[model samples]
Target: MSTTGHHAAHKVVVIGGGYAGTLAANRLRTRPDIGVTLVNPRPEFVDRIRLHQFAAGTGQATADYGTLLGDGVRLVVDSAERIDTAARTVRLASGRALGYDYVVYAVGSTCAIPASVPGAAEFAVPIAELEPARRLRARLRELPPDAPITVVGGGLTGVETAAELAGQGRGVTLVCGHTLAPSLSAPGRRSLATWLSRHGVVVLEAAAVNEVRPDAVVFADGVVRASALTIWAAGFGVPRLAAASGLRTDALGRLLTDETLTSVDDDHVVAAGDAAAPSGRPLRMSCYAAGPLGARAADTVLSRIAGTAPAVIDLAFTGSCVSLGRRAGLRQFARKDDTATNVYFDGRMGAMYKELTCKVALWKIRREARRPGSMIWIKGGPRPGQPVADGARDDHGARDARC
Candidate 1:
């Protein structure tokens, strides 16, 4: 065990090695005054947004996290079982305890499947993790060319999966509980609809699923028989780590965080990615939010350690990018707050844009992992206000008053 002393440096613990957690650890590693430790089950980072492409038999989507994390950041290859906030310790499944001065909770999220839905768990496959998506891809290759496939959920994942399957010359149908891409603006939605139609994808909006049979998906109004494969790409909820830690969280298990991404119930604990809820509003679960939010969490931690007041996390979603396949996609422009605007792009240009976005996201992770503690250069434009300096804030604010 490392000796504890009255040192000038503060220890920062980051859970999960996905986009948000990895970036947070990398950013914190840049500061010599901060001791950073990253805990995750996997040594490599998987680009989850491209899981659809992997499922459609494209290529492997894994990157080495060892080379990605900056120096001075300790990589703990284990799952975090629980976080003891009061004790400032994290319990790992490997039977080790990590003590930290600050904790960044970026445990990420999971694909939620309703237990009430019969046969759903037994038969349907979800692209929640990389292995499952890869398995689905292998399953697809084994099926007959004209086999019927049903994709549940009309959200971005479902749409992308259906489009990819259709492009692969399989008969595909999308079953959605509400309108397809419900979060998208009219122009983006229309563009997606046209693209799906062009690729021979049968979209059934407002269709509530009742049960899943061996070869069919039964809906409330009708039963879609002849389904050779079923893909569930529904909504996602955060892992239960926050609630299990006795921290304040939303109904979906997202940690309730203040404007600066610090946990409301414990200032020493901050959350980002799919596991973080920003005050009254719930940030959308996307890599776009996670990447920036991760950096903000690290900044908040670093500022607190340096006694500097952390800048408020200004989370503004500029737009949405959805890939239909390798060749087609939809780029929907939105306001700073993510309100969909009239601007839309389609066809190969949109696909290229989506690919570039993924590249940029990975690039940010790579850059931060190498340099650490540096401000992520926003490609579009500058954000208002001066960057918060490290160690300018009071230490008393790190404790939760209510506790």
Candidate 2:
């Protein structure tokens, strides 16, 4: 907070340092009159899209904040405990409070091993966030070379995790619960399915995990499969900070905001990333949407400070890509509203698309750090108050966000 001095005309505190939060903090620096302080639990920036690669010992998942955050943006290595909207203060985990003229609620998403499943809470390893991914990486290292590994969920993350392990010559079984890659078209799913089968991995589409034990996985139909290591890549969950702070949220605990990404309760509190439910129909939870939402949130605050009406959200989705392994992948083409189309890229071409997307996502964040407000996204998504078409809703229960 010291980077901008204590007496700046306006003060903004950004919660969470994910792609959205980091970009929002940097974008706010466009106005020197506005002082920005970012509050995050970790000191380094995490490339969440690479968490699966990290868990499989294929790639690193963190980047130095110095290389990502913009100048004059103070970084606070503390988690936000609560947001007292009435008092305009944010309570931190370290027993300190930060006052702000406005707050960006970009606290990102996470994955949890369900306690309802007997022993899953104890034996399963989740690879969606930093700590869980770290644990999975360490656990993989500790296991023998031929250990039986099971990946739950058939979404993009599940598909990627199973493939990465299988490519490394591990015995991997993917419990799809239902259909595999539900977001992809029939042909695209077939392409990915073919790649997985050819890599010596077992695909179980109808098997829903009923319970997880230290030595095996019990299916819903009472069949038992031996699994030495169970990697959980199931559904996602957002932090309860917004709900605990008494903000209006959708059913999934995403902050309920207007089309401009401003909170319904108060204009001083804006939201972005996976945590934001703009107009109650949130976009997919991916780095793709996070970057633009971050910039939009900053624009909303700047508009208020300048006494102008903020523009509504106008962002579109191209598609989602997932790596089959380091060598193969799939890119499912999507409509402007994010529904899957029949067109897609597969094999070596798909792998190139996946790698390029990852590199470009990071490059966009770094570009924003160097040039505030220079970030841009494709327009023509569903309008405010417009209903998202069938299959355009967030993929719950199975898939993590698309690539």
Per residue, candidate 2 scores C-alpha lDDT tens digits across 1-403 of 2465367889999999988999999899899888899999999999988988999899999998888988888999999989999999999999999999999999988886777789888999888888999999999999898999999878788889999999899999998867888778888889989999999889998677889999999998999999999988877789999989999999989999989999999899999998998889887788888999999999999999999999998987777888988998888888887778899989888899889988888788889888999999999887674654435222233124444
Candidate 2 residue pairs in clash (backbone atoms < 3 Å): none
lDDT of each residue in 195-261, candidate 1, tens digit only: 8888889998888888888798989877656688999887665788888889989887889987788
Candidate 2, poorest ten consecutive residues by summed lDDT: 392-401
Total backbone collisions, model 1: 8
TM-scores for every candidate against the unseen true structure? 0.90, 0.96
RMSD each, Å:
7.7, 1.7
Off by over 4 Å in 2: 389-403
Worst 10 residues of 1 by lDDT: 394-403
Note the residue pairs that clash in candidate 1: 306-391, 307-391, 307-392, 307-393, 308-391, 308-392, 308-393, 309-393
